[model samples]
Target chain A: MNETADTMNVPRSRAWTLFGVFAFVALIAAQVHAVLTSPADRDMGHLQKILYVHVPAAWIMSLAFLVVFVFSIRYMWRGQEKDDLLAAAAAEVGATFNGLTLVLGMIWGKPAWGAWWVWDPRVTTTLVLFMIFVGYLALRSFVDDPERRAQWSAAVGAFGAINVPIVYMSVRWWRTLHQIQSSPSTMDSAYVLGLRTNAIAFMLIMIYFIRRRYELARLRRATELIADAAALGGT
Target chain B: MNAESSLAVDAQRIARRFGARWCLRGVSLQVRPGEVVGLAGANGSGKTTFLRVLSTLLKPNAGAARVYGHDVTRAADDVRRHVGFLAHTAGLYDDLTALENLRFAAEMLGRSPEGLEASLDRVGLARVANDRVRGFSAGMQRRLALARLMLMHPRLLLLDEPYANLDAAGIDIMNAVITEVRNAGGAALLVLHELAPAAGMLDRVLTLVDGRIAAEGDGPAANAPTASAPTLASAAGAR
Candidate 1:
């Protein structure tokens, strides 16, 4: 058991380091490729460059939330502390990306729709998803017991996940300022390549962020256990 | 296996560290079936940490603990099944009545609520079983917690400061509950600050100082005054 745990730790740290370097290179490459290869849109010109950032951020935000949902369920089902930590890590990363998506969307909207903010279904539901997880993080902070916190947060994480699909479908379900979902097949090949490359870069960065966050969470739990032991003393 | 063949609590070279300090440094002890052992320790001496570790709530930083030969870390589910832990707090929901609290515990443990009323009566809380715990005195809440323990009938009892906040009657009830558990061939590790109150009920007493066992003796030996040792109550208060 000790050997397995030790071996796993080495690989995980190395993997995170590799992901960090790769993500940085991929992000720069994607940006350069999009600028040089993709033609300016006739309608919006260079403003369309924002899609490379906006769409990928939105995709990764949804992906991160999906991770939270899965890990939260696993925590509840298996009652493992690692699962709870992973869920928390995913939620934190997801919240950051969700915020980025909103900001980027707003920036894009300012030029495309002549408004910085709107009550569009896609925008409103994504905002709600972000707020729900923010509330979930706040709830975790308020609970003192580790077990109780895991149980409550798992419930909140699961409930918050229901909003992900709603946010994804919102643009299609309603006539909104937000455009319908786009796919690689639906867009010009160059635009598709740029978007895909940026998405991969963002995904790698998100994984690295969540992994590091999980490490911090584990360290915090260890410190808490030690402190608890110190406070209580030996019987 | 017979009760005598199985160890109720067996902890060996246990160590739990916090930052640079060790709260439980190579502490080890054992309790057999039908034995009631009292643990007297100064504040922050790691009494509660030991109990929490044995109860499968906290993992020891080193060494191993077993209840009936089931390792705490490897078989926590089995350890949990055989152990009942009552901390200084009642661990009860204030909104629930005494009866409701027991019912909730019973449900969580997957045990029927058939004997909850009897258990409440045993703890002298039957008269106020329907009263909300929010309105109960500290002693009453403690009794309700004891009632919950009685219903569970765990094979090993880990009581941290069981005498805390209890009146004379409550103390007697707590003693009776411990005696009953021993009489049924279960074992108990009772963590206390004062030896005088539980001395008569203890088969043996272990004194902890600086996170290690300083001494071990029977009831009479515990009552013998030691100039350097401070009672748990005094040490706890100083902290």
Candidate 2:
């Protein structure tokens, strides 16, 4: 009993800590190169620079939600606490990127559309997606029981996952002011490298965030179990 | 048959800790079929922790345990099939009527809803069958929980503080349930804060001190628990 029972409670390895260092460095290098090298857009000029941050943030936001979806299903199917913790970590990361995507979209929208905000279908659905996950995070806070919290989070993840594809296709499905997704084939070649570079950078940063959050969630679960063990006068 | 298969519980050197405090320090016990064992310990003595481990609600920090023939950690779903766990709380839905609660439990346990009225009657809740649990008193709620146990017919009962919040009649009802388990050739382990109320019925009593099984006692006479038996003496030495 004196022994530390779980490997999960161990501190994050030095390798991962070093990876965090590398990820931030990569993000800085990627951003600096993209902003300096890309030619100004014919119409939008320097405003095109925001795409380096905006587009990748949107991509990572969706990717994070997809992680939540996969892990949520895994939690439901397997009832493993690790799957639930991982899904929760992805949701927190997804919400952060979701907010970033929306904020950047607004920054671009103000000049591009002559308004800071719009009710465009893509914008509306993305905002809904953000709220849905923020609500998921909020729902987790209100539950005290770990098992109940996991089940509830999985339910909310199901709703949030369904909205991801809709947010992706809002431009095509509803034909709103939001532009269709950009790609290497559609964009000028000079911008593609910057976009792809930033995408990888954002991905590394997202992984770092999710892993850190997951480790904390596991630590918290350990305490919760200890507390439950100590309940009813545990010695 | 193997010792594990013949015994209702076979816990081997079980241990658990909270931070630096060792709550269950290499404790071990074995109870045979049709026995009603009492686990008597003071506050903070790990009695409930041991019960939780056996019930598959909590895992041991060290060692292994089996409920009947199933390994509690690996074959938990199978162990759960034969165990009825009654925690300190009633684990009831306050909004559901007495009858509705039994029906829901029966459904979850894959038991038929038939004879639910009879089940409620056995626990003296049939008269209040249609009333919501929120309106019931603590004793009544415990009765309702006992009613649920009858529905499951689990082979082993891990009851935590079963005598708490019960009146004299309620205690009698509980004792009858324990006897019922024995009569059905099932076994039960009861966690007790005090031993007298349930003394005569217990086939064995194990006293826990600082997370170790420091002592044991025999049937009925178990109210005066003695030092550890040979099996746990070796485990205590291992610690």
Candidate 3:
């Protein structure tokens, strides 16, 4: 690690690293167990196995967006720098998972739906949600002042979060090619354990990603503040 | 004692830090109404940070500041109403016309954004009132920022590098606004690297070195500050 990051003495804890390791191991274990235990689907054979990663990733992505929504609201309500930083971190992480979810969904769609993509309400809304957050990240980079960036981002974040529920409900609200949702209750007894375990693993990984990303954002902000002070001759 | 309570600014040992670096160590100062104080220092001396603390852009970490009797931290909104702070950047929207910019400020301040043409005329930007700030020259942009202060009716003006891109006429317009604020029982704090351009308009010069006031000197006339250049230069250079 660069010695300068230690200037503020904000130590990065070992717990996050340990948690990160556990999460990845658990994810791999879940994938391996699901591939072995679950028999081929009646309609789709082994192709239904994509549901393990796709469903869990989609769930985790939605959770990340919800985190963005909560933190953005907190930032606007309290005007704390931490809230803004957390919101920004979750937004970046959410955008990453959103891209992942879309890709995974397409991979499943190509084989299962026999199309690479469809104008499905669920898919379209998720794409729109992804675009809004990309624009949110772009706005953050474009604005130079920290305060302005936080304010504009908080507003955009709050508005962008409105799309999450829309994305979630798109299938039921409109007759879409995308399935409504998959859960332990609706899935077969054999697949429920895999789906539940995969969701749990995905949640753990997301927590690790968001927490580590937030730590980096805090360090980056500290560096910028220190640089401003250094430029002005303060030590 | 009553008069002291009425001072436009009263800051006591204000301290603020960024990360592990202390930008302002412990700075204390007072500015009476009808005064313009020039804050001069070399880069990194905390002159700009001091201004930021007072303007409520950044809060003090270990001390206190009050603008016109309102605590900077606890009553930041109240302090903001009395302060017209021109930060390092002009903080103007590029897409908005000069007139529209002033109108936005007015509306933000809860005014109706009417009678704004005269603000443009005051800054000699009347001809380009409808032109977007993106197309305006640096000097013109500075003038538009000044027009915003004029509209706000601030009791304390905090300006950082007010003369960087200004021409002679822009300089005069800025000084006139500062003078207007002083004459109306308000005060102004100016952070300037080069003192000569605004020297004649300042009432006192405070040289901040290493995050503290190192020297102070009186201005030219009843309220002019030209005579303080040497104090500022000597005090800043001594560091």
Candidate 4:
């Protein structure tokens, strides 16, 4: 309720730059750690290294989607436009990472599993999550008015958010043929440390993305309102 | 004999600005219980802005408005509970049936399921209860919105162009409903272009020109022959 215009201008560039440096360092460290600490699995060979990128990216994607759901609900309840803008920004960033996660997962899956794609529980659910976000973005684009857009998008965000838990649960409840939760609990301490660092770095990257996108949204809202005011009456 | 003596709502020097432009400036008025007040204005004359502020949809930049002792800003939820606002959009779900739309509104307002059926019939939409609003004509949708209005039975009704684009039958039904509300001791602020059309239903008439009240109070302009060109100072000085 006490928000001001200055709140929208958080230092996005500083955040982005810091996250970029962290991600780059984490990338190099992950590769080095993989080379020094562990031998390639005899079955999957060198392809397993992709886990360093694929797994953390997947975690970050899910986290971003979670942010989208939280902010969307907050927006609807409070009617605060900032929450709506943040939700949209997070959904966009999440979709980008989710798309990347899916592509990289497929890349890792092909040789190890002897197929380019499989109807595995985790993969299928992630794909569905991607489609839901795609629908969210499409819905946002279709609406024109800011308040109406926010209201409708919040509803869509809420409905689509219900799918997230379902996606997570499907792998556990029925197990339609995805790898059981092996990666999170089974990794060695050093490997876990690398993955966690990468995940934190990715989170920082997403924070930066959402902040920048929010700035753009603020600018768009200002421009549209200006045009409306001008059209109404401008001497 | 006189339920109209008490003021149902009051606005004290209410002012709202969008950026540099003031939509309402130094606007003050009183709405008596059982009285229908008509807010007449030209396009962009700030009627909608004023109503939005009063309804707690948009916060005012200055001054205060109270609905039945509830402060609009500090106690917005309380204000919302007592105020029923129907903006130009009708605020209805186009995908749901007339009954379904009213039922959802009823649920939102925390009305019992039993009341939903009665409210639908009250608004004359019981015959079209099964039909989806997507297939509803403008009149049908307007009736559906009226059904939503019945669910709340609000103390202060804020309607923005409720009769606009409505057919003759729609207007008649709306007039009847509004008249019934005023008779039941509810204060209403109706924004309309043609005051003469609704003048018979209104207890008082107020004109807004350039974000300030041009002239207002007690019945239509009876004595003033050329009330249209009232000076801004005279308008602002209205009690």
Q: What ranges in model 2 sit over 4 Å off? A: A1-32, A71-94, A139-159, A167-190, A204-235, B13-26, B56-63, B86-137, B165-170, B224-239
Expressed as tens digits, the lDDT of each residue in A1-235 for candidate 2 is 2223264474759999999999999999999999999987787778878889999999998899999999998888988878888999999899999999999999988877677787666677788889999899999999865667889999789877887666768644655445543321246788889999999999999999999999998887677555544542332
Model 3 Cα lDDT, one tens digit per residue, B89-207:
77899999999999999998898777899889999999999999999887788888888877888989999988878888888888888888888888999988767677578778777
Which residue pairs come into collision in candidate 2? A233-B44, A235-B44
* Stretches of model 3 off by over 4 angstroms after superposition: A1-14, A167-186, A219-235, B1-5, B12-28, B40-64, B84-154, B157-185, B190-203, B208-214, B220-239
Worst 10 residues of 4 chain B by lDDT: B230-239
Clash-forming residue pairs, model 4: none
Q: What tens digits encode model 1's per-residue C-alpha lDDT throughout A1-235?
A: 1112222232246767877888888888888888788897767777878889999999998899999999999988888778888999999999999999999988988878778876676687778888987998899889866667889999999988876676657654664455543322235666888998889888888888898898887776666654554554445
Please provide, for model 4 over B69-162, each residue's C-alpha lDDT reduced to its tens digit, 9 standing for 90 to 100: 7788989988888887878777777788877787787778788767676667766777888788888776677777877876788878888877
Q: What lDDT score is found at residue A140 in candidate 1?
A: 89
Backbone atom clashes (below 3 Å) for every candidate: 7, 2, 3, 0
Please give, for every candidate in the order listed, the TM-score of chain B alone compared with the true chain B.
0.90, 0.90, 0.91, 0.85
User: What C-alpha lDDT, on a 0 to 100 scale, does residue A29 get in candidate 4?
Assistant: 69
Using DockQ as the measure, name the better of candidate 1 and candidate 4.
1
Point out the worst 10-residue segment of candidate 2 chain A by lDDT: A176-185
Best candidate, lDDT: 2
Per-model TM-score on C-alpha atoms? 0.73, 0.73, 0.69, 0.63
True lDDT of residue A39, candidate 1: 93
lDDT of 3: 0.81
Best by DockQ: 2
lDDT of model 3, residue A50 = 86
